[model samples]
Target: MPAAIALARQLSDADNKGIRLDSASLTEPGTPAEAFAVQRETLALNGWLTAGYKVAIRPDGSSVSAPMAHITHASTSGTAGFDRPAVDALEVEICFVLGKDLAPRNTPYTRETLLDHVAAIYSGVEFLGHRLDDGSRSPALLFLADRLGNAGYVLGEELPAKVTEPGQTYPLTITINGDAVFEGPGKHPNNDPVAAFLLFANALTEPVAKGRIITTGSLCGAIPTPPRAAIAISGFTTLTVTAASTRED
Candidate 1:
């Protein structure tokens, strides 16, 4: 097994108590498979609570290698802390709530069946481990064990649901401290992000509930959104969320 798993598990344990994990302990890294398993187990060890379903990571428009990217799993894990209802200086992003549980890969599913699980869609942000420079492994696996590297996801109201087709484009804009950092649409600089999500979403066996949101993935590679830094994922009428470091009361 990769040391990343053990370190991640241990770190995950500490984080659940509102303690942050240390990245330096991940000295002996493992393969993507190992890293992924550890992440799943870690989530189980802690408590997945009420969030699952994943978004796809498309090649950044500025990338040279078009990797066969995107991985899926339950969300809202990790050791990072943020405001629950909200923090003062939080990094916010838009998330999508799934209508139903998903079938595993290779299963036949249709737009109608998919929509039957109809639930309201909304947005939120996930604070996972960043700045660790654990950027050496495949994003799929690193994300797998880092407790999906997500923490304290928020959501939007369930009235005006966004029922996305398989190939539609999702426009995204991320801002920090009110300065626009990323602005784009589509996960595959070449393919559609909605298609990517559908591909994975359809594969899961169960449908997602009324409030489970998907952050999609980073429009920008990982960057730190600092104290009092507000991030807004500008899509679907724009979701305004924020994050900031606070002393535990």
Candidate 2:
């Protein structure tokens, strides 16, 4: 068994729960090939713990080479359920969904090939938790191990992940407490978030035999959650959400 899997089982046992990892650990690993190895082991562990998912982000926010990343567990929900009362996170992101469960990397890319997963795309939130004592601040593997660290999923029924054209631009707005946080025409994460998702997906190829979910990355800054706060996102037009905390929940 890989060290990450062993470590995950240990952690899971300790928490009596699933494991989730951070992206920082993979940025500059210590040992030779340590990063890639850790990710694989993490994926292996994820298969045992929960489902899988991905997050593709433009690290540069404007380049496809921004390194598409991934996380764990894909979820489907309606728009009404997006807020702190639903899950816990230091931040949230607005992402689109492809309607199909993708095949492995280098596979043929097409509008039709990516539409089978066919669920509506709505605004979902991802929670970035604080770091712990062991220098583990949610490694990438933990995200895989814990299934995209899925706290709660919120989606709109009218929107669809089914894309007929790759260039379709959707107007989106993400706001918190009435202040507009993110407003832009949502583009595919990598010209095709689905394809971008597949790139990272192929890297950790072990878990998909069962299935996986990809988040592609945040299109903008990660909103900081101060607890008992409100956050919301809308597609085509920016929808809003408000939250209140009693001295920070």
Return the top candidate by TM-score.
1
Runs in model 2 deviating more than 4 A are 9-49, 57-111, 116-122, 130-153, 158-170, 185-191, 200-212, 235-249
Q: Which ten residues in a row have the lowest lDDT in candidate 1?
A: 62-71
Tens digits of lDDT, candidate 1, 1-249: 546456656745554444443455544335545654565556555665545544554354211111111212223431222342212222333345555544454655565565455454444444543312342242444544554445445453332444243344556677777788766652422233344455545545444455455545443455555545565656543555545643232
Candidate 2, residues 103-146, lDDT tens digits: the string is 56565444444545434453444554322222223544343343
Per-candidate alpha-carbon RMSD to the true structure = 7.9, 7.2
How accurate locally, in lDDT, is each candidate? 0.45, 0.41
- Runs in model 1 lying further than 4 Å from the true structure: 1-5, 13-33, 48-50, 57-81, 84-94, 103-107, 135-140, 157-174, 182-191, 202-211, 218-223, 232-236, 246-249
Displacement of residue 81 (Cα, Å) in model 1 is 11
What's the true lDDT of residue 72 in model 2? 29
